[model samples]
Target: MKLILIRHGESEANFANYWTGWLDVDLTEKGVQQAREAGRRIKKANLAIDCAYESMLKRSIKTAQLVLEEAEASFVPEFKTWRLNERHYGALVGKNKTEMTQQFGKEQVQKWRRGFDEVPPLAKENYFDRRYDGFDRRLLPKGESLRMTSERVLTLWQDQIVPRLKSGQTVLVCGHGNSLRALIQYLEQIPVDKVDEIDVPNATPILYTFDSLLRIERRIEL
Candidate 1:
């Protein structure tokens, strides 16, 4: 089976160098173009996507739609889940990233951004929208370290993704940078400390071919 992973294209937050965890934001025109180009690249690779997954965020949802449309696989089943959403930045939400780096010092901000267990400062209130209404409020994140993101994300991976892959379905996961990183950390079994060195660029696609047992046979960037 083939599995493809792609981070959502640049958002307005990215353009402004801001932290936008759990903030609903739209993509810029450049971001839209980036997503389209990603689709074209996948089309060139001739990989037929059978099923797709995305986070609840529109940025991720739209990217998956565009990719499947571009790859001529628009009819594929698409799934969206809250667990696949971006890591919550808590009090860091809407703050400028560069300024945070300047104020907090590079080392500290880096820890919050990339460290496995370093959670950002918690938000004072729960600002989740109606979309999250059915979920238990206590389960919502105030802020999340990579470890926390992994715990929730991997639950969906184990429960939902593994089943389809085992059924011989080709899957496409379009997600945010940190969420995708958590998934990648699990898939590749990368050392947690070493994960800081990994960076997922916007709209770029990574393809993994798997054996019948779902073991990774090979990986390639499309």
Candidate 2:
């Protein structure tokens, strides 16, 4: 089985250096190019993608579309779910990371950003977005630690992605940084404290090949 994971390209908030958790934002021009490049890379590697997955957010969805178009794999089935969205930053959404560091000390902000169990402050009110109308309100979180993000993503992997892989399908996942990180953590079995060291660059693909028993045979980056 093969799994390919790509983080969505740069967003407006990314350009502005702000936290954009759960915010719907479009990709920048360079981001579009990056997505296309990722697809081209996949083609060059001669990997036959059978299915794709993405988050509900526009940036991820758009990246998946662009990638499929460039790869000429639009016929592949693509699934979108909120479970792949970025970790909710709560009140920190839209706040500049550097400014937040100044406001709450560098160490504190670092913990909130990278610590597996360190959840930030919750949002004052729940956002009533129509994109999530059909989902259970309880499933929507105001804030989440990396551990929390991993739990939800793991559910999707176990229930949806793993079965597809077991059927000998090559799956592509276009998602956000934190969400992709969560998946990587599971794939690599990285320790909780060590997860902080893992960084998923935007629009880059991480390819994994698994044996019949689901043990990793190889990991490649493209």
Candidate 3:
């Protein structure tokens, strides 16, 4: 079985150099091209994905569509859920990273961004969104540390992704940096301290091949 994980192409927030947590934004022109190139890469690899998954966010959803379209596999099944959404940055949402560093000092901001258990200052309340109407209140977090994000992400992984892989199906997961990182950390058994160093670049695919027992046989950037 094969699983490919790709982060969405750079968003307006990413281009503007700001923190974006659940900040639904679309792709820029460069982002579109990047996504297309990612598709070409996958196509060249001759991967025949059976099922695809993405976050409800437009960036992720759009990236997945573009990938499949370019790969000439638009017919593949797609599943979108909030469970694949990025970690909530709380009050930091929309805040500029450089400016935050200036205000809070480098180390503190680094901890907030990379430390496993370091949660950011909480947001006032969950934003009203129809997509999350039936979501569990606890899962709709004010702010999430890596540990917090991992818990919910792992739950979805077990419930949705594992079974398909166990049946020898290929899967493509399109998501954000932290969400994919959480998944990668689990799949590769990355230690919390080192996991922060692993990045999911925009529109780049990381492919994982698995054995019958579902252990990763090989992982590479495609």
User: In model 1, what are the clashing residue pairs, if there are any?
Assistant: none
Regions more than 4 Å wrong, model 3: none
Candidate 1 residues lying further than 4 Å off, grouped into runs, are none
Q: Could you tally the backbone clashes for each prediction? A: 0, 0, 0
For residues 1-222, write the lDDT of model 2, one tens digit per residue.
999999998888889899999999899999999999999999999988999999999999999989888888999999999999999999999899999999999999999989999999999977758888999999889999999999999999999999999999999999999999998998899999899899999999899999998899999898
Write candidate 1's Cα lDDT for 15-63 as tens digits.
9999988898998888898899999999999888899999989999988
Candidate topping TM-score: 2
Higher-lDDT candidate of 1 and 2: 2
Tell me the tens digit of each residue's lDDT in model 3 across 148-213.
988988888999899999988999999999999999989999999997798889999999999998
lDDT of 3 at 81: 86
**Per-model TM against the reference:** 0.97, 0.98, 0.97
Best lDDT goes to which candidate? 2
